[model samples]
Target chain A: MKFSATTALAGSLALVLGFAAPAFADIKIGATISETGPASFLGDPEAKTLKMLVEEINAAGGVNGEKLELVVYDDGGDPNKARTFATRLVEDDEVVAVIGGTTTGTSMAIIPVLGDAEVPFISLAGAVEIIDPVKPFVFKTPHTDRMACAKIFEDMKKNGITKIGLISGSDGFGASMHKQCLAIIGEYGIEVLADETYGPTDADMTPQLTNIKGKDGIQAVLNPGFGQGPAIVTRNYAQLAVGLPLYQSHGVASDGFIELAGAQAAEGVKLPGTALLVAGLLPENDPQRAVVVAYKEAYEKATGKPVSTFGGYAHDALRILVDAIKRAGSAEPSAIRDAIEGTSGLVGTTGTVTMSATDHLGLDLSAFRMLKIEDGGWKIVE
Target chain B: MIMRLSSKATTLLILAAVIAIAPFFFPSSYYFRVGSLIFVNGLAVTGLVILIGYAGQISLGHAGFAGIGAYACALAPIHLGLHPALAAILGALLSAAIAFLVGRPILRLKGYYLAVASLGFGILVSMVLSNEAQLTGGPDGMAVPELGLRAVLKAVGIDLSNTEFWYAFSGLALVLGAWLALNLYHSPTGRALRALHGSEVAARTVGVDVAHYKLVAFVISAIYASVSGSLLALQNKFITPDVAGFMHSIEMVTMAVLGGAGSVLGAILGAAILTTLPQVLTVFQEYEQLMLGLVMMLVMIFMREGLLPSVAHRIRGRGE
Candidate 1:
């Protein structure tokens, strides 16, 4: 097609000038998600869930008699762009609360910007550092890697497993979880007999698995990674006939992992995951059962896609933020922030949240349910 | 000669006026942040103009220098006990030294060979930054200390908002970068660089050390990229290894080429357009990438000489 410089210039000019902020008496909630890049699997559903919740909330006559205006910017998983968007959300959109930061990098990048602005930010990323020291304005909804490690070790302790081989992807999530697990393994009376790591894009993990399998006293194997790495490890474990129970981190708490690793190979694999992964399996009286079931149904029906734990993080974040905003009795940033901090006994998808000044995540080990892959689906194991 | 001097002065004047006056029209402080980002990118692209436009040497891994600069800012304050401002200088010096060393060998290669060699260097830097989780925070990245100049300015009764402070600081940096680059354009070394760019053999016969001039341009450009990275790290107070990623190096080159690689003003305009395009296109949401690609494609098709130079050529054509 023939193109003209004048046309391109005029088009760009129109786009730049086309942004006209509408007058809104509603509360503005902002988000900066990694909506379109390498982290899109996490951020796409997150953006969808946030948009769906905002619609649902507004449809129910909004929060505190005011409609919610969600200003979401796609950062394309770039931390620098995420920082810019976080600043824009606070300084330009003037949002009372933000519910994003899809990746750990983006979360850390956005944290200081929101902290400086004193705008309450509930990140969806699963990183312990996001709230370890506990920034005043930063909160997260997902269970952290540390919590995941503790949950896995608790299961192993119950099983009377004393020694295990540790294999992790050298990516951010795996490395952090590996460190967290090692730090607390001594408390669990478990010895990591063999610890190994594979590169993120390593097509074959057989060498690492072989090395771990050769350890004499290893009772089980644990893979702490997300994406296809754990699936590859799982397959290699089965191929090598390791004859040991394999544990995976919450990073791969999805059906896709089973499908990728093959259902047969994935059978008997255990991991700590959110209740959203087993919404139908929860007992009727469980507090999270209703919330998770409702979110799963709504998300599935709206997007025609299966509900993921990633989206559940966004669901819990929005619900918590909106609930806090409602209880705060004001849309003031500091008020919303304090309300988020004081959030207690709030039942949501990730589990009942009870945030304190010292604990911004508000989720304990109970937030992660130990589930075994059985019959090609998740089976709640405790 | 007068015409050449006037053109240089005009470029600087236009750039300065835009930096000084654009904030007045900004709807919010967010625009100041975006403007500062453009200037930061412009500083780096100005440097590329020296390497690619002046010396005709292609570097596909200049972002490696940028990574060093950014990490230097993040690591220096805690490890070396240097102030953030001084850390930026340390970063620039380190980048220059690395560039000189790397350029010495790799600058011997021509065209695509050099491009691939530089690209490997960039990937190697990013791999280290990503793998060294203990120091660089791995892929999650590390927080950068504040430049702390704003507090000093406030103490002197000239307080500016964080975004405004960065906007003014980065704008001044860009102007200085452009001034230095324009000065180099007319200098004997720059002439030698340009002469080599035109014909290496002819320039060599005319006593122009082709290899030395190329190395000089490469080192200078690397310093510009490093300083740009340091400014970005300081202003945002956060950074990830993505600064040194291959895509960023491509972006620097794209900004220079798309705006008119041969001219400092043109390259800065390219940087401004590219940086602002993403911000403006975010309104497209899902279609943002499609629209961005389409715009860049169209610009490349129609403005073969790049956005600024082609338009300038048309204006000059009309003047006749």
Candidate 2:
């Protein structure tokens, strides 16, 4: 036993030395994405996008003469692990910027860690609070849930729909969007006739949709959540034939949702999504068309999978950081943070990002494009 | 027969040696993060050692206590103007009280029935934490105030980095928790609880108060989970309802059972393995859950009594 213990100790020392040797100075960026767990649908693409972009940047003469080194860790959708990895990235990896917290919970978990470490974190998640009480070192590329609510409501108003029913998930993303939807319903002159919620793992949301269907004067149904919940809701809505038009949040902006819900069930469902989803269909005169098209083409060609807004978040985050790093002319975390905050009118895959002292998200309602699922593909509605 | 130290002394000695020596193998502060994670989990598993190991009671929802403890650290300081440390204490107290109140009625059920009841309680707690957006931040989670112990240490000329500080702090907490648990194992109450674990009817016939002892174990374990949760929230400076979610509760149980729920050392061993294994598996990324499930299945199949006990049994081999 003693002999084995000594041998194990010696082996660990050798391993540590092996890791310590030949550390080159590279422009290191870190990411904690939910690559293999519940949020993997968001993270797998985001990780691939980040990896592809880092390679492309390095291949294209690096980030201003320094090779981009991305240190990616799969957080498994756990906040605790996200916090740990965030700390590791800042203190151990010494990364100047981080760019992928694949879920709202994981994103929020790392906010203080990166804020204190003074490393700039560009979150890919869409929770409004991630940037609401803006931490100086934190920014995100995705439009907030509040913005999604606004965009959906604006579209509903244009369609002469005023009375709506809400069915949100009981998870963090769902609850946050639900709150925002409630808070802003009055502003949109929309009455919430039925407000119901289901668990994240609920196999059926027909009961809730059934409740919404029974509500008098309900012009539409709005279900706000990511992952399997919205898909299940869509399937059940179609199964139950609720007949009311279903509006989903930007949470289900991915093609995965359409596939999961089945084409017929997901048909005609409207959502607010980033331009990445409709890059192929965008007109030549659109401001975001070029960048969106570039990212979508590069990403799809590299991964052989369709472009997703989740990946767009990572793409936009890295691009924003590179832009900031070029302007700042230093790899220092503090300088990168300030440069990122000072960003103005930088077109990203998501939208025109304009960061300031108070607004770290740098996205307005225009960042969202009203999209509908047509023939199992996304189509621009307006 | 070979002479051996008392179980309590052996457990403490092992814990001290492991905590003191493990840092030598740590490659970076990243390892410290993994270490602190293991200790926090170890602390919670140690609490389960009392309820599940000694009393032979199962709690599938102890993470509910952990959630309460974590949210307390996040909310109390913000709402009531208390220091973060004091809020942790308050969270622990609240967890203990809730455990006692809930345990009284639920402890009467046994086996799968008890499991279902505890599971319901956990689900309800997570639901409230998620649904009550006004207080709990409605799923985006709320930030915990800093504990400020590092500042105090800095003033005293004992500066330590955040990762280093949490690693030491949580390690010390685990040691303290293990010591208390070890001491309890030697107490007469411990004997009564163990007796009830052996056979509740037989224990009742022998004049042991089964309900009272079960409640005591439940409350004690709940306090353990609460403290562990507080430590986690204070360290990460964030709290989510997932802390109290059914998954976390299942993780606590799995850690205890996988290590040897009957032994404090075993429980800690279980926590250490489960906590560290995931961090190591983060490299593989895609194979994490598959690998974890395979490891768990192999352990259960080969070593029915858990890792430590089964390994120790093999070493002792036909002795005793």
Candidate 3:
């Protein structure tokens, strides 16, 4: 059981040599995902979708005759890893564009890296800050927290719900959505009767829900956060029998949320989600329906897992980048960046995407569709 | 390897050799980023070494100081109009003051009580950072103003790439920090701290001013963590409350213990191993955490004193 420094050093030496960047290919796209951490629910699918999409695109005679290659690294939800991998994707892999960042923090971590390198980075995480200040080389496919808030509020107004209670996790995603939801609540003339917060790892949210339920004149409850927190809140809310409309952020838009919260607990819950969730429910007239249906089918077939909104984000990012590459007629980073910014009316899994010099994330509030959980399935609410 | 060199000389040599040869081995900027990360973590853990190694005081919330240091860089330029460098100093002073104030009362408690108190301190700082949306940018985290030190260096005809600059800059900081710590180890104050660490009652009877020495160690370690945090924020140009989170504090302590918290070089070696291990394990993806746990467990079980100390002991012909 003696410690051997030489053996340990050799092991690490082999690790470094083994992972030395492989040969570069034409039309390279790189991605960093949280494939095995707190955000792995999002990253696992994101990695799969990127791998599957690249294979499909290359199989279809590549993008304009140049084979598309993907270089992916799992960031494990660590900002440091995201920064390092992002820099490597540009400097070592020499990718034309990068897509990834499964969490708001990791996505934001890569902003300065990609901005300084002047390479296009399409973030899959939700956060207005990712693109609000509008870093030149950064973009995202998912609707921002602001857009999610607006969509949920509009739905709330339609349902004649004005007074509501809010509970959010104290983590990065939850706190950001809480702020956005609060900022726009006044616009919809909705009054937040009770605003409560819970820690990300809190085992029970019943105290917060109980306080909200005790509040007078509260017609609905909104919880904004990703992972187990939202599921915990949903369970607690249903257990308390808080006879109010329950709303969630797009963060918990995946089927995993329902499974975690239990179908009975999640029933009648409304949230803003990407079109991919209820792709089968969309009518033929919807432009995104076909794209969603195709992506979901291919993703489920490729990975043998149910499609998640996170993967759709990556899928939309790749399609957007490929469209820009086609329009720019070059695989150069600068050209691809400009072409991506100038992108207009490209059909995507999320919705029809339009890019401009100012708006890095091209999707509008329309990108988010109001979905309700009914009978253990997502039903699009028209 | 077992040649008669002083530990200080050994530490300096290792630091110099790593700083000099790491760049040659770097395949790209990626390794530089990882290298900078190691130095940053090493810098923080070096501070912990002074407290845990010399003073025998355990802190489970030192990363809170790092959080303070990081947000100082992020917010000071915008709010106070202070330069980033000055902001880092401000952060260090602030961390020192807070640690001193908190240490005064909590340091009286022994073992688990002190650990709990420090853990609470860290949670409180992170909670404030996460809750104070207007100032700390809530949890989405605010952008840090560029330190622009590399640009300044470039103007002086010492142009280095971004990754290269961070790697060298952080490496220099770690070297400086380690130099100070090593010098302190031989000083009268360090002797007093170690006396208290061995037995506070015995040191008190010997007129060692037990509480004062412990506070000094705590404050000094807090400053070290703060400076490290500031460096990380400046390099990454991003700051999150997670820098001060419970897990980060655990990582800092784990790095110190894993390397041999008792020695400056050992602490740094621990930081390097843990930081590099995760990066290298990225290739394994799914098995990353499993392997990391296994390595940590194996090391703790076999090399009880940690990687460097145990290996050094063996090399020096010590008992198995």
Candidate 4:
């Protein structure tokens, strides 16, 4: 044991020395991700796709005739880890850009590192504040809770739902909805009859559902979630036998949610997902239809599985950044930042993205397509 | 033990000198920035040495205090209309109060009970911070008001780069904290706490107010954590709930243990090493967490007495 310990130190010393005199390195793009931990539900797959996407970028003659070297650090869905990784990337690796933060909380932790470094980043976390206070350098790919609120309410308006009830996850995701649902629904002249919340790892959202069900004029349901919270809602919504339209946040719109919620429980449950999720059901003439289908084919061929919006987003995120780098003809962070800000009509598997100087969250309400679960498959409702 | 001091002090002076003068060799301003973070983290670990090493009590929730300090910077201006410096003081006071209240009950419990209770307390604090949107701006995080200290210093003919200021300031803070902790290690109360650590029952038989000494350590450590957290937020100008999370608390403990928790200087060194290691290991970014876990386990396995104390003992024995 003593010998091995000494040898290990020696090996690390050698490794350090080896790094001192390196060849001209590739454009180091760092990503802080949750490769392990509870949120690995999303982060594990996100990590896998990050690797594949970087490999693909390099294989295609690389970006700007230089191989794209991706440096990813696992945050384990932890804010401290994300902060540590972010600091390391900016200070040590001196990477040109940063990407990925699986959980909302972790992304929040990394804000200081990016802000201090002024490194351009494309954050995978869906929180608006992650980009809001410090724009120009930070960009987010996913839609915000406010947009989700708007999209869900828009569907409620279409369905002639005058009264609504809300259930949300008890952590940051739930708290965002709890605060915003009333405001967003109020704008549509819809009344919120009840607001309920469930713990993130809770196996049952029934008591919350039962409370919401008791409220008068409850014509529909709205639940915001990412983990099992939505699945619990879907199951409880069915068991209650109350025949009212249910509107869910896009978090539960994943195929895994449907499978977990069971087929019968999912029907008529509406959400604001993308055509990319169930592109097979999208019309052939739809613009995103072809892009999504190609992605599904490529993803399936590579991972030997069906394509998720996760893989789609991961692919698009790297593509957009690499495209920006190639466009700028330099790996300098400011140039890439400017190029990203000016991006318009860039089509991806999900939808056309357009970023502006003011708004780093590139996706609009239109980026989402309203869908209702029908016949065990998500079909367009509007 | 008498002879160990001369050798240990020499080693410590050498280490401090290296850190104080190391930036001249930095290849870029970036190195200065990273070195500043190491110093900042080292300051926090120095506080942990007082709690974990001298007091011989455990706290699995120091990060909650850090959150208090960070959010104070972020929330003080927006919520209470207070300046950032006063907010930092407010954060430290709040952390001390909270630690005092929680430590009263938990400090009496030994071993895993204290660990679990402290862990629960930390999780609850973090949850409220994340869930309370109206006040904390929720999990999306809020911008911290910038510290005008450097600007103030500039007005007084004190010219320093942001990186240089943080490195020097954090280094000074760590040195002050370490000096105080070292003094306390030799004080009457410190001796009592160390006696209690050796045997709780024996401590009581010898007229040691074990509970009071333990609570004092907990509160002081919390104040240290809060100040470190404030320094972090002020430097970065952003704050988030993640500051109070479980992993951060664990990382603090790990650094304390790695540095030879018995001495604040050793803890600071541990903090510096871990802080810089991952930055240099960018090529193995994917394995960063795995490496941390491995290093922590290896250190705990072999370096039972900790990095500084153990190494000093070996050198003293060789000299003898």
- Predicted model with the maximum DockQ: 1
Question: Per-residue lDDT tens digits of candidate 3, residues A1-382?
Answer: 0012233345445644663242334588889999887788789999999989988888787777788877788887878678888987887767889999888889888988888889999999877778888888989888778888999999999989999999998877887788888888899999999999999889999888999999899999999897799999999988999989999988888888899999999999999988888888889999898899999999999888888877888899999999989989999899999999998998888878898888888888788889999989998887
- Write candidate 2's Cα lDDT for B1-320 as tens digits: 12223667778888988888877766567678877898999999999999999999898998998998999999999899999899989999999899888888878776655577778888999989988888997666888888999999999999998888999999999999999998887788999999999999999999998889999999999999999999999998888888999999999999999999988899998998887666555555578778889888988999988989999999889675
Steric clash pairs (candidate 1): none
Instruction: Give the lowest summed-lDDT range of ten residues in model 1 chain A.
Output: A1-10
TM-score of 2: 0.85
lDDT of model 1, residue A116: 80
**Residue pairs in clash, model 3:** none
The runs of at least 3 residues in candidate 1 whose Cα sits more than 4 Å from the true structure, single-residue gaps closed, are: A1-23
- Global fold similarity of model 3 (TM-score): 0.87
Off by over 4 Å in 3: A1-26, A153-175, A181-271, A372-378, B1-7, B200-202, B318-320
- Every candidate's CA RMSD: 3.2, 4.5, 4.5, 4.2
- Model 2 CA lDDT for position B222: 94
| Candidate 4 chain A: worst-modelled 10 consecutive residues by lDDT | A1-10
C-alpha RMSD of candidate 4: 4.2
lDDT for model 2, please. Answer: 0.86
Answer with 2 or 4, whichever has the higher DockQ.
Answer: 2
Score candidate 2 by DockQ.
0.39
Ranking by lDDT: 1, 3, 2, 4
Total backbone clashes of candidate 2, pairs 3 or more residues apart or in separate chains = 1
Q: Which candidate is the best by TM-score?
A: 1
Report, for all candidates in order, the number of backbone clashes.
Answer: 0, 1, 0, 0
